[model samples]
Target: MSVRDPNPLDSRHPKRVAIVLSSPAISTTTGWPVGFWWSELTHPWLAFRERGYEVVLYSPAGGRCEADSLSDPRDPSRYSDTDLISLGFLSTPKLAALVEATRPVSELSVDGFDAIVVAGGQAPMFTFEKATELQRLFVAFFEAGKVAAALCHGVALLRYARLSSGEALVKGRTVTGFANIEEDFADQAVWEMGALTRGTHLMPWRIEDEMRALGANYVQAGLWRDFAVRDGNLITGQQNFSGAATARLVIEALGG
Candidate 1:
């Protein structure tokens, strides 16, 4: 439950991190509002802060960013109603302000940061892969031997992010993301709720399918279980629930 117990020296020298979120976008498949997942951001932010690391929020483009409706703790759908962590984050004026107005990735670089973590939601399926600057920053952190992590659909960056050597960053690495089986359930839930057709999909492509295509040693756990995979400086989480677990891997990799 610890957020930050600041070290006196932190002001002079802090371990800075860039936590990236997908920009606000209308989902092509669902035609619904989407951005980042609330828990995916709040949980990992808490984890990193607990270590006194300064976590800066960023988006593909600067300005206010939205959260997928279902991820909102106050949403009428009640999908994330039990997420007190997000509820607390949203209630706090200072913490909530972080996501409301994010700095654009294009305005920053990998220069001063020691790590980067990408949190995902419906928007990443439509935004992350094509945001060259975001991918570049993620890859640059890895190439510099710094911790680079992503959770849920955010892991999609690994599919398209390439090293300076001109090869996929995920190649030969063990990883996990939003799985195909979970995607099936998400589609089914929407169908039962009458928001989508029986055979329609909420995602244009499956994260599992693409990660497998990249020949990474992809693995996952039971539905909604907190699972994370760490391969060197690269860390990945299976879903939104895996945020803190994945951040711990990043902390370990940083020798915390």
Candidate 2:
């Protein structure tokens, strides 16, 4: 992807976007960085900004956030290379500015945004498991008929989200997220390091399984490839690598 100019371009009509953060910080168990997965946040932010959308970053519990080091291009884990659009955004002052001033979920008004993106990392499972505020934000976005998306563990929120009629928002809608195999690979790495990797943080139950239980149309592309699925206004990307693809899908769904 080509790096674009960062001139102060404004949206024709500000299309507000609310991105939810997972604040649990990674575990020493996996030796991953202590924070959000880079691409899941950065890639989509870049895509939205490039298209002239106003992006807002927020955490479940507001504070300074961190990005996974392994997801950073500068990490030693580059041995297993990833084409991270995030790295590109991270280097830009305009994009980094958003991350610098992210607000808390409590401060976000769901109706003010055109769409909501739930970002993931190893931390989400721990942080978002029973987070009612985060769940409410997602539910509000879906209820308002705005584009709602989640990548990787962020998809876990969909498991708890319901419609106004008390039905699963994802019921009968196709969705995808980090698969069991990918989780296995991550957990194995931590085990090899002789660290205690928590099964809950890894692939406890595949998104497909829970989606099946919710009567969602669940699909998984080949592992670690850039893939995303759009089911009505709910767009879901499988993993970190799928962030950019998912963001474009959001723009397309929003009629950008």
Candidate 3:
């Protein structure tokens, strides 16, 4: 009798997921204190925890993860009022502990996880682009046929993720993320005093532009819609609102 090896891509095993957060911690183009968004991080976390998947949080440079000021309940902006998932997450001491001791991606091996999710924030545009390590990690996962997901500004990585063949990871995949029009509207909003600052224009090229440039299938649902797309094993969400749905898509793709 011959013993066969287990197929790692098979979703029967308990999934070990690693989620990457921002480190340089600055807004995309505005220079504001950057961190993960409330719903973007918590909703997906809740979805994963509910499915009994083990979750690990990592930052590019490692350290405590910060929540964007706009997402803070104590902030007057109240930008995330409709996000109940974040509200509950912020209220829980145990759940709050994750941000306090998040491991740096430098200390972990992406290959050990079944899948990896790159969570977003206003800061991802700044931190993610320069994160060569993260780019490499994502490419490795993509080549290995593992599930890879990103939301909002986190999708910026697709611009830099090159495959072993020197092709972009999103070259032919359909995906979505924070839209340029939303950025324009956000900049015009009270968040900024109409200075047309750097962080205010960080998104630069919309997901549609960059994805289309690479010949990748790109779509934008709306300004702030809960839209997510799954291309093969790769999953992507439009914005913060799509976090939960994106996570569910990830689980479903894994055959849960």
Question: In model 3, which range of ten residues has the least summed lDDT?
Answer: 4-13
lDDT of candidate 1 over 184-228, digit per residue (tens) = 999999899898989999999999989888878899997989999
lDDT of each: 0.88, 0.79, 0.80
lDDT of model 2, residue 251: 85
Instruction: Please tell me which predicted candidate would have the highest lDDT against the true structure.
Output: 1
* Models, CA RMSD each: 3.4, 4.9, 5.3
Kindly list the per-residue Cα lDDT of model 3 for residues 1-256, writing each as its tens digit: 9776442334456688888887747554555677887778788888887777888888888878887778776577666776777888888998888887888777768568988899887777777778898999888887888998998888988889999999888987899988777777776764466656435455546666787898788888888889999999889998878898899888887666
Runs of candidate 2 exceeding 4 Å displacement? 1-10, 26-34, 79-84, 193-205
Over 4 Å off in model 1, which ranges? 1-12
lDDT of 2 at 170: 88
lDDT of 1: 0.88
Q: After superposition, how far is residue 155 of candidate 3 from its true place, in Å?
A: 0.1
1 or 2, greater by lDDT: 1
Per residue, candidate 2 scores C-alpha lDDT tens digits across 152-204 of 87898888898889999889889998877787776777667665544524444
The TM-score of candidate 3 is 0.88
Kindly report which residue pairs in candidate 3 clash with one another: 29-198, 29-199, 30-199
Least lDDT summed over 10 consecutive residues: which range in candidate 2?
196-205
